[model samples]
Target: MPQTEHGANRRRGRDETEEERADRMWTDLIQEVRVAQTGVQILFGFLLTVVFTPKYAELSDTDQTIYIVTVVLGACATGALIGPVSLHRLVSGRRIKAQAVRWASRLTLLGLLLLLATTSAALLLILRVATHDGFVPYLVAGVVAWFLLCWFGLPLWTRHRHTVK
Candidate 1:
């Protein structure tokens, strides 16, 4: 859909009807979900194996608590990332591609947020355990701030800046 000066974009591309647009959006949403899903799955896998490591027994009570929190966060992230696929599978052939895309987009956003939290918690746990310095929290905070700026802040700013009134 090409935007003209009068805000008329024909509501679609030259070769695409509304249905086609919805279908394309659905495919794009699924592809994006796959990328996030892979990361969450990998992180969850690693977290699951952590408890069986010999170092797990040597962790202090606080480190152990952090580990538990991190693992739970990873689990939540995993669920959120994989949610869109299940949503699409259940809703297939229901003629709801537009609605499905909206729901999937929402799920993807939620998954990104969960991923942020999971990554932050994992970094905290790893840094604290690897180097019991007071700067671990600060370092993790810095990294989380960077992620926030890149993942959420900049996109929001661009959306607000470019949106027509």
Candidate 2:
């Protein structure tokens, strides 16, 4: 039994070493990235087709700008979500699982943030085109709030509340 720094058995039933822990974390991260990558890729694919639609020309200049920005953000999110695969392929068998996991986590975070922005912009553009109302900002704000809760607030709260010392 390995004594912990607090003079207790540190092993929590699974006596995984640092490398093994990193490998586990890496797999979990990859699974998470896969979910986000799939969503962003689908969204990016749809956004890419919007410009070819006849309705695109009917959009106001402001809405056109919003669509452009949203598409760009979606593209960025797609790239960020897929970055881990490229990173792993390039660094395969490099004996740097910990570093790779860290990088992948960073990329995933970036991807999520970009996804949030992309979704928000897309919602705003769609609502403005569909409603043409003065309350579009409020609608977009409410949707953004919901997204914040679902994507970030809940996860962070759970992590903080349940993480062991």
Candidate 3:
């Protein structure tokens, strides 16, 4: 069992060396990243095509700006989500899997945040274009709240509830 700096035993179940732990964590992170990467890549691809669409030329200035921001956010999210693979490929056999995993995890989290922003912006622009009503903002805000609750609030609550003191 490996003890933490505070002298708490840290083994999840079976005994694992640092390298073994890193390997397991890396595998898990990769699995999670695959799902996010696929979604972001698809969204980014669709965003890329929107600029070439005939309707894109008719959008108002504000909507065009929102579309640009959404597209940029989607691109950034795609990069961050795919970053872990590049990080692992470049750092493999460097005896730094643990550090690499940490950085990859950070990138994944940032990617998720960017994805959320991209989705929100896309939704806002779509509703504004389709409805042109004041209720668009309210609807967007409600959906954003739902997304926050599902993506961050629930996970944080579960982690805090289950973590040992």
Which digits, one per residue and each the tens of the lDDT, describe model 2 over residues 1-165?
668888987655557898998889999999999899989998899999999999999988998999999999999999999999999999889999889999989999999999999989998988888897899999899989998999899999999998666
User: Which residue pairs show backbone clashes in model 1?
Assistant: none
- Compared with the true structure, model 3 gives a TM-score of 0.91
lDDT of 1 by residue, 1-165 (tens): 668899887654248777888888888888988888999899989999999999999999998998899899889888888888898899999988789889888989998999999999999999988898999989999999999999999999999998756
TM-score of 1: 0.87
Candidate 3 error regions (>4 Å):
1-14
Which candidate comes out best when scored by lDDT? 3
lDDT of each: 0.89, 0.92, 0.94
TM-score of each model, paired residue for residue: 0.87, 0.90, 0.91
Total clashes for model 2:
0
Judging by lDDT, tell me the better candidate of 2 and 3.
3
The parts of candidate 1 lying over 4 Å away from their true place are 1-17
Give the better candidate number (1 or 2) by TM-score.
2
**Could you give the candidate ranking by lDDT, starting with the highest?**
3, 2, 1
Q: Model 2 compared with the native: what TM-score? A: 0.90
Cα lDDT over the full model 2: 0.92
